[model samples]
Target: MKLSVVDTERCIGCQSCMFACSRLMGKAGLSRTCIRVRSAGGMERGFVVIVCRACEDPPCAKVCPSGALKAKKGKGVRVDLTKCIGCGNCQDACTIGAIFWDDEADKPMICIHCGYCIKYCPHGVLELAKLEAGHAKR
Candidate 1:
């Protein structure tokens, strides 16, 4: 499955997706979640949902000293926790600010494109799409 922001304007900043992401990872909070929803500026300014775009050529993988971040075509980076040195290089290399940190483990949290959180988005701000080759992502 492929994940994408369907409409940020429709978002209510409920953070249901964020919680769902953590739940899928066997957690109860944002600590382990790859998806993030943050207030853009003020409450009236709306919210921004930050998640991996599954870049065709992810820079995070290029700067990863341990090669822990591996880019997948039409999918996001696959993180190898064992190989990861917790150096935060991948986090820094992410231009979209999708890389989330695990404060307890000192590791980066990248999306696996499971689409587990999409179902919890009550307002349809996020969605899962078919991972078709050459298909332009929204």
Candidate 2:
């Protein structure tokens, strides 16, 4: 699977995706949201949508000292909270800066690629794409 940036120009920077993620996890506030939306430069320069790209070999999982992260092919990695030691290696390994943090829990927040945030993206800036066979490295 793929989560594509349909059009960054259309983004309104409303932070709807962040709220959607929190809501999907049955929570309130953005402290634990997986997706992040921030201004590119300033309000007039538009915004940037930060989320997981579902890498073939997710470095996040590779750097997990506790084996808490599991890469699921093109679906992104699953975080086993029980196995997670609240280490920050996975967060640093993500080149795209998709990994988020929960200050209260001291654990990294990651996207499950559930597409929950897509519906709330009013500008149509994001869309999930299907990955072809062999699209990801084995």
Candidate 3:
């Protein structure tokens, strides 16, 4: 499966993804969202939806010393808080600024590609795609 960002031109900077991410973690606010949509230098440039692209070889996973980040089967990565040392290595390794920080937990928040936020995206900015049976060499 691939978690891809669709056309971002329609994004209105509503930040629904942020809320959805936080909600998935049972948070009532945006304090714990793995994804974040912030204004591009004052909102005139539109919005940028920040989230994991589920790279084939994720750099975040490589830099994580505590093994808090692990790739999931046919999907993105999941965080094991018990193993997280909060060294911020994953955050530094993320080139797209996808890994968000949970200040309270002192750990980086990441997308698991659950597709829950896709419903909240009114602009069709996000999508989850399933790979064909023989697409990737096993």
Candidate 1 is scored at a TM of 0.93
- Ordered list by lDDT, greatest first: 1, 2, 3
For every model in order, what is the number of clashing pairs?
0, 0, 0
Candidate 2 total steric clashes: 0
Taking all chains together, each candidate's TM-score versus the true structure is 0.93, 0.92, 0.87
Over the stretch 12-117, how does candidate 3's per-residue lDDT look in tens digits?
Answer: 9888878887998999888988787877777888877777877666788889998889976556678899999999999999888888888987988888888888
**Alpha-carbon runs more than 4 Å astray in model 2:** 133-138
Candidate models: Cα lDDT each = 0.87, 0.85, 0.80
What value of lDDT does candidate 1 attain over all alpha carbons?
0.87
Residue-level lDDT of model 2, residues 40-95, one tens digit each, is 99979998888887888889999999889999978889999899999799999899
Off by over 4 Å in 3: 131-138
